[model samples]
Target chain A: MQVNKSDLLRRLKKIEGQVRGVQKMIEEDRYCMDILVQLAAIKSATHNIGLAILEGHTKRCVSNAIRSGDGEQAINEMMEVLRSFVK
Target chain B: MQVNKSDLLRRLKKIEGQVRGVQKMIEEDRYCMDILVQLAAIKSATHNIGLAILEGHTKRCVSNAIRSGDGEQAINEMMEVLRSFVK
Candidate 1:
């Protein structure tokens, strides 16, 4: 499951803009509730982008590794990422 | 500015368990791609938790600072976090 690189990048760029907007809202003394709403939106966008990448990894990298008998190592690598990701 | 502490904790705990599960999958030599899928799920959960916290901060902490004319300081704190977050 290879990722659609362009689509992922576009989503990431949109999230980046949203983050900047949150910062600007704070600087402008925007309403607290509004800022919070923006933050939530950004978070949701980020999660979506991560899911896209993860989907690709599962479809392509992981499957390839399993077929090549490198499944254990691939799993270990993913585990390492998950440790930091959750942290 | 106050978070629903219980909800945040519940989400974090779930993600923690997911991370542990990913590790176990690796230990058990579960399917490589399946492990990757699980890892992605953990990442998504962790992001949601982070968003919850960030929302609380914006609603409570940032607003409070603005009312007290500490808006600059509060914005700076958030910026610092964004720096690391986007990195």
Candidate 2:
């Protein structure tokens, strides 16, 4: 599946900013709780990006594979990937 | 608890590089699966950062709070933050 380039780039840039924010927070000797909170935000942002990518893949790649009657292997591969996705 | 400055900065720098790598991949129109995998790596790295900060907070702040006899609320707060950590 093709990536939504602009949406991805925009989201990634936001994540980049968030990561830098955490770095600055650390440099400033911010509270540990604050840093943890920021890290959680980054984690979730990345997770959402993964979900977006997965959505595209499912809507395109997986669907095509199924239409081609190669559905089982494609579905299995996707499930394996999804298994890795759980924290 | 104080953050381990050098360690965190180093890790964040690596993460910064990873984020940039993802941006480059997007620009090059890389495969969706590859980008998704990279995002997973970023998610794990951020999760580790959170774990490190949580470790320091638990070892120092939580311990101190307990020793000072305010253990309950401190532990409760930490648990609340942890609840958010799960994907």
Candidate 3:
């Protein structure tokens, strides 16, 4: 929540574009391998975006919460989300 | 390419919607960890879709290629895409 988010938004836009590209590939009946490659790319793109969010949030939000003596709740919330990430 | 594609197309549409949902969350200034969770979900969704495509392609396309004595190329292509998937 504390990170600069405009860049993240832009990444999301690119990911949306990738998704649309895959749809086009499907419609045109492109090779399955080609479509699979694009899908993998989308997965990795989302992974990187999530990593960026986690790093920015940790460096800013988590640290600030700890300094303010509110670290427990922040940490708990982060862990839950982290669990979801691994799932 | 040999997979039943209508279901895959439906899955893609859902993924596109999910991407749009993430964009909305970003625009609304949602929590960073929450956004991270959504991104992780998107990654997994893509993974499942990729798996579906691979399974279908292998059972149909790969077998047909082998029967037609054209398997080496199809297999090599599938390997390349699988490598990309792991990346």
Candidate 4:
């Protein structure tokens, strides 16, 4: 979690623009397959953001928790969030 | 877009299990990079679910809106959701 918060937000903002672009493409009657391609790219970008967050969490929260002997609780909380994300 | 809802839910449930497994690996003090690799897998799984939803929305909602001459508004609504997802 020692990463620059603003950097992460900036990356998210870029993805926001891409999402808007995809919406516009859909509205403009773009080809179905083309739209799916754009959606795939957006999904990949989203996964990158998620990966960044996971890296931060593992490096900071998980490491700290393990050192403090609270790793189980921390992992449980992470599992909860992950389950929610998948849902 | 015509995909079975139950199938999607089933896939998500499996991903939920994978997420929990990753958490368990973390609690056992697995290597940092190994945890990141597991996280990467989870993120990819999540992206797959997102792709399915996006496909459904485009084929059903967007296509219907286009035929009904409400495509612009529908796209705007979709943009809102995309914004939230990136956030």
Candidate 5:
């Protein structure tokens, strides 16, 4: 399934807000632990988005390739992406 | 700066081969140091792809948002992705 650009944009907007909030907290001298906690939450959210995108790619592009007898190619591509993603 | 899906797929395929090679190495009881080095290379490649995507997003989507007066939202979304990405 193709990802909706608008939907992605919307989610990104929310994330941007969260980032700014963190910056504000830092500027206000918020507790270090609190800032770290917020940072952790943001990291989780980001990873979730990555997983979602990866899932979508697997379901749509990769699966299609496999069905078309390009499974090896598809799997390879995914590995490449995963390599970078985990870094 | 839209990413070409085909290009992405091609790169992924290469990465897949590398991963399989790594697996094979492990199965063959290849030197641990050799395997670890390959693993590190894979990780770096993966992160590079992510950065490429992120740069594209920033240049295309995020920048567009800013130009269109949705800067706040765009930045937020990017931050969200970054949070997870670093984790």
Candidate 6:
């Protein structure tokens, strides 16, 4: 499964807007809790995006490697991605 | 700064082993809390990996883009990565 680059871009643009909004909120001295809420939303959005990419990668790259009798390599790649993701 | 693919691969190999260990723990009927603790460790490890990549990307890709007067593009790329990450 190929990653939908354009769709991902669109989502990212929106997220960027949200980030900027948060920045603005901070500049304007928004309540701490309110800012935290937005921050949480941004975090959740980011995590969702990660999950999507992970899903796609698993379906396409990892699955192909396994099918090709290179399961170790695929798992290695996945682990690499996950490592980066968690960091 | 280019990403250190070899180093990343090595780290990932370790994480892969951890994941497999977790699986084995499950199969062996390990305590749920113990398994969860391992899971948490894995999650933290994964997040650390992500942080490293993000740091590298920011110091290299994003900073370069800004220095070259392509800040918008860099930010957009960052947002895309963030989107994927949060999901």
Which candidate tops lDDT? Answer: 3
For all candidates in order, the CA lDDT equals: 0.59, 0.86, 0.87, 0.61, 0.72, 0.71
TM-score of chain A of 6: 0.85
Can you write out model 2's per-residue Cα lDDT over B2-83, one digit (the tens) per residue? 3477898989999988998999998997877778778888988889889988998899999999999999999999988888
Give the alpha carbon lDDT tens digit for every residue of A51-83 in model 4.
666667878888899999999998887776666
Local error of candidate 3 at residue B56 (angstroms) = 1.3
Cα lDDT tens digits for candidate 1, A1-87: 124544544554565465556555545666544655555565555456545555667678877989999999977876676565445
The second chain of candidate 3 has a TM-score of: 0.88
Error of 6 at A78 (Å): 0.6
State the lDDT of candidate 1 residue by residue for B1-87, as single tens digits: 114554544554555455456445545556544654664565465455555656667788888899999999998877666554444
RMSD of each: 12.6, 2.3, 2.4, 12.4, 14.4, 14.5
- Give the docking tier of candidate 4: incorrect
Name the top DockQ candidate. Answer: 3
Worst 10-residue lDDT window, candidate 4 chain A: A1-10
Say which prediction, candidate 4 or candidate 5, comes out ahead on lDDT.
5
Tens digits of per-residue lDDT for model 2, A1-87: 234788889889999999999999998888888778788888998898889888988998899999999999988888877777764
Error of 6 at A30 (Å): 1.2
Best of the two (1, 5) by TM-score:
1
Q: Chain B TM per candidate, please?
A: 0.89, 0.90, 0.88, 0.82, 0.86, 0.82
**What is the DockQ (computed on Cα atoms) for candidate 5?**
0.03
lDDT of 3 by residue, A1-86 (tens): 43567788888899999999999998998988889989998999998888878888889899999999999999999888988886
* CAPRI-style class, candidate 2: medium
DockQ of model 4 vs. true complex: 0.07
lDDT of 3 by residue, B1-87 (tens): 335677888888988999999999989878888788778878888999999889988998999999999999999998889888976
- For candidate 4, the TM-score is 0.49
- CA-based DockQ, model 6: 0.03
Off by over 4 Å in 6: A1-3, B1-87
Whichever of 2 and 6 has more TM-score, that candidate is 2
Of the two candidates 4 and 6, the one with more favorable TM-score, higher being better, is: 4
lDDT of 4 by residue, B1-87 (tens): 224455654655565565555545545655544555555665566566566666677788888999999999978777666564444
**TM-score to native of every candidate shown:** 0.51, 0.89, 0.89, 0.49, 0.48, 0.48
